[model samples]
Target: MLTEINFDGIVGPSHNYAGLSVGNLASTRNFGRTSRPRDAALQGLAKMRLCLDLGLAQGWFMPQDRPNQAWLGRMGTDMSLATAELRYAAMSASSMWAANAATVSPGADTADGLCHLTPANLVTMPHRSHEWTGTLAQLRLAFANSASFAVHEPVPAPFGDEGAANHMRLCSAHGQPGLEVFVYGLQGGSFPARQHRQASAAVARLHRLPAERTILTQQSEEAIAAGAFHNDVVAVANENVLFTHEQAFADREGLYAELREKLPQVVILEVPTSAVSLADAIASYLFNAQLVTRPGGGMALILPGEAKATPSVWNWLQTLLSGNGPIRELHVADLRESMANGGGPACLRLRVVADPATVDPRFLASADRITRVEEVVRKHWPEEIAPDDLARPGLWNAVASARMRLLDALGLAEL
Candidate 1:
């Protein structure tokens, strides 16, 4: 049966707070602090469990080979000789945000009747630019069922694409053909726009989505300036319900009109600035929550724990739940490590509509699988990584081997 599978990137052993992202408010705010990789990975695992308990299928991608030695070789220097900036970039665990791993167009929405996936060419950030190649490898391996899936290489760089983070689909159900929205940015003044309009348009072409069902919209510069680096930071859609902030798009009313024209059933739950300011929403990652359909009925908002702490955001959410809206449930996930680096519940997974059987079994999530992965994590992941520790060769070796051990445990040693 066709269903939605959320592929989460297992937090890597190299996970640290180097704060390499420029426009990410949390990344900069928590810069130069210590990071707990083991705890982070465990926290991610717990979040995945929450997903499973909610009757959603879950899958995972192993961490990329960090202190990306091969990348450094191309840069004409090994880890020992590279500059501090280069070293930090090479070892970054930013790939843990699998939402940027790729943009997936389900077979239901594609022209060829095969799910199409395009890994994002994250060229805008040094820590993330090198991620596409690694992410591509994982995507290919997981979706190797050629008859049912087509995984495309990222849009060639110079036109930056940040994958599913800037994409959303609205339909009556997961198996139905849907209206796909590609949100991009033209300018953000001081903060550079990461998702280029051309890149998003290119992805639509690559996926072969129908022109009538696709809406390429521009993100509001004001939202980007307020630290909404990716569209998912301000909005998320599951089926027909679009839970978003008021100032999320450049032409909010126009975009809504287009959406209604394309998919009249689209329920846009827009939170007003009066109730929750952009600052509060960005800080708590309110819209970064996964707006997923629950098993019994209705929908649930899986928000970060920080959202509950932000009074304005929490109050608004409470009011939302109290109303007769389609969103009737709420689940708070503790993701302090990820939140500190500016990723929330939505940032950690790539939503793909497909049968669980099509995915590589080793990557599928279950209670038993989580246990096995947890053992490897407990045994190998670093207890903590100080910013200065990233410069040490010992840390590099540990990070590399830890990932390999995870691969071995999962019978994916070839990766």
Candidate 2:
């Protein structure tokens, strides 16, 4: 049987406010503000623990070292040429959102009968563009069984790939073959369109997914302009249910018609424009939610704390919960640290479908591992980080030391 594993990235000590993502409203609004790395890490850990309590399979990815010297060398930039954005990009801890780590195809969906992973080439933003290499290395290390797993190089660039953030899968159960939906942005509008159609098609082909089981669609330009930087920002799916805003896609009606015709059992839980405007959805991150099958025999919605604060969102959620639908529970995870930077509960993890015993044991989480990770965050992580802190003479060393200490504690020092 296939189990859905959530591999969340540990927030690093180098976490700071850079406002690096263009279409992300929170990132822009919180730019240059003081950030509490310790608090951020703790918040993420708390969310993971909540998932554990819910009986969800959980794992973790280590943070990448900041002020990556090798990446700096690749850019050939010295201190003189380092602008604030450039410096922030070099030291960005955005890798903590592992949703952009890679596009995963479960063993059931691939032709080779092995799970496949393709690290995303996040070429849209300079800060994220440097993450693919390190992300790929970590992925390979965490999923090391060559006979059961195939971790591929990123699709060649010029075709920006944002990984699973723009992808969704729908199936009757974890072990069954599913319909893979690839969402791409045709226009950047005010921000860059990170995933290209060509890149999405390439990844689908690489997995050798049957054409009859795949769907490619364009994201709405209005959504991008309103800060829906990734498709997950406006849509989410679990099993046969797709929770999305009315304006999430360029051709919403047509897409729904096709989805219904193809999947037959597909349930499109679309939020009408009048009830919750597209702008309101983006502001509340209503679509950036984790839709999961509960152990109690029904579905649940895992939303960030911000959703509770938004009146429309909260009301709509209540309505959904009161109805005779698949979603029977509403969970609120306090992910303010991640939310302030344009991410939510769903952004913190990459979903992998496989047996826990089949994956690399080092990446799996247990009570002991969670306690150790909490200890590391509480003891070594910084209380606060400012925008200018990236330029401090010993900042790099400090961040690296913290990360190394955590890796050692987690027995993942090789990464």
Candidate 3:
């Protein structure tokens, strides 16, 4: 019963393009280091708007962060300027619906909540709660309730290095009757050299979730290739297990073909050829795809990638949602640098509960049709604030200025 869902976004800074960030193998600059201000602003704007739209449609969006931000910085990090970038994006998303009078609940009020994983906060492999405080605040405003924040315990050190933790992969939330499946790998430290038995034991105690739900896939010893793996087969939806074929690792053409052949029922998107390694491949998938299940259906399929090179995947998506399913596309030509920095549409958003009364169906259209929250402000505000204005200090200054202008234009008095 696995059903395919398609989601598409133009490559921009906001959408994390894993292919670009995986070690210059693909020859793209890191997003943070890009000199083009326009591209950055566009990517940022597109991503923030996209997150809002997707959150409205799916009722949830999860954003992950880790402590390795510092390490990544030292090791040539060029993606997000700060964890606050993600936070800011989430705030913009909720505020858009709120300002537009859309029916959307804040994360704080929902039974299911968004998880922000951070380093130093590790108790579980990915360190799932550094930004909990800020995340909670956004949820509260969106949902007006405190039920939204779910701070998972820190991932154990033995499970993986900071990179591995950041790459925490989502496995099938279904299967094994009441068990949640999660697959992660060990990237740095002695942990990768040792078997993850200790890490498994630690996860069992921390989350109170079953240990069987956790699957650890170790990095390969050879030249690291994207999506390469050994025997470690973990279920994704119900019966689908993601495995790596050796030949696929050796031959990109073969890997692409195999993915198409194996995932016919689902959409198989080839991460742009620009993408480099398994880690980048997985990150690209997590940052862009969503798990959408229709009411009454028990299975789901990962949506295919939208890059033109992956025509089969795109066609499959079009075919799947051709009829009744709602589809929205957002084009963010500006985020090229951000994707280079590492993050896609999903990484830039934080999902909250939905409010049926305020939800706008048009907002659910693809990126091309949906009006960006920033663009709305620019168009409706009484005064013009150039994108360069964002570079100034006093972060809320621009936001407050824009808000006042918007309210004035609407002829509404300040509350």
Q: Can you give the TM-score per candidate against the true fold?
A: 0.99, 0.98, 0.42
Candidate 3 lDDT over 17-36, as tens digits, reads 21222222222333233233
- Where does candidate 3 stray beyond 4 Å? 1-28, 31-56, 59-133, 139-178, 188-204, 212-288, 294-306, 310-338, 345-415
Error of 3 at 207 (Å): 3.1
Cα RMSD, model 1: 0.7
Error of 1 at 117 (Å): 0.3
Clashes of each: 0, 0, 51
What does the lDDT read for residue 343 in candidate 2? 91
Off by over 4 Å in 2: 78-81
lDDT of 1: 0.94
The positional error of residue 43 in candidate 3, measured at the CA in angstroms, is 6.2
* lDDT for each residue of candidate 2 in 55-104, tens digit (9 for 90 to 100): 99999888997877778777788434677667888889999999999999
TM-score of 1: 0.99
Cα lDDT tens digits for candidate 1, 1-415: 8999999999999999998999999999999999999999999999999999999999999899998989999989999999999999999999999999999999999999999999999999988999888988988899999988999999997999999999999999999999999999977769999999999999999999999999999999999999999999999999999888999999999999999988889899999999999999999999999888887888998999999999999999889988999999999999999999999999999999998898889889898899999999999999999989988999999899999999998999878
TM-score of 2: 0.98
Clashing pairs in 2: none
Which residue pairs show collisions in model 1?
Answer: none
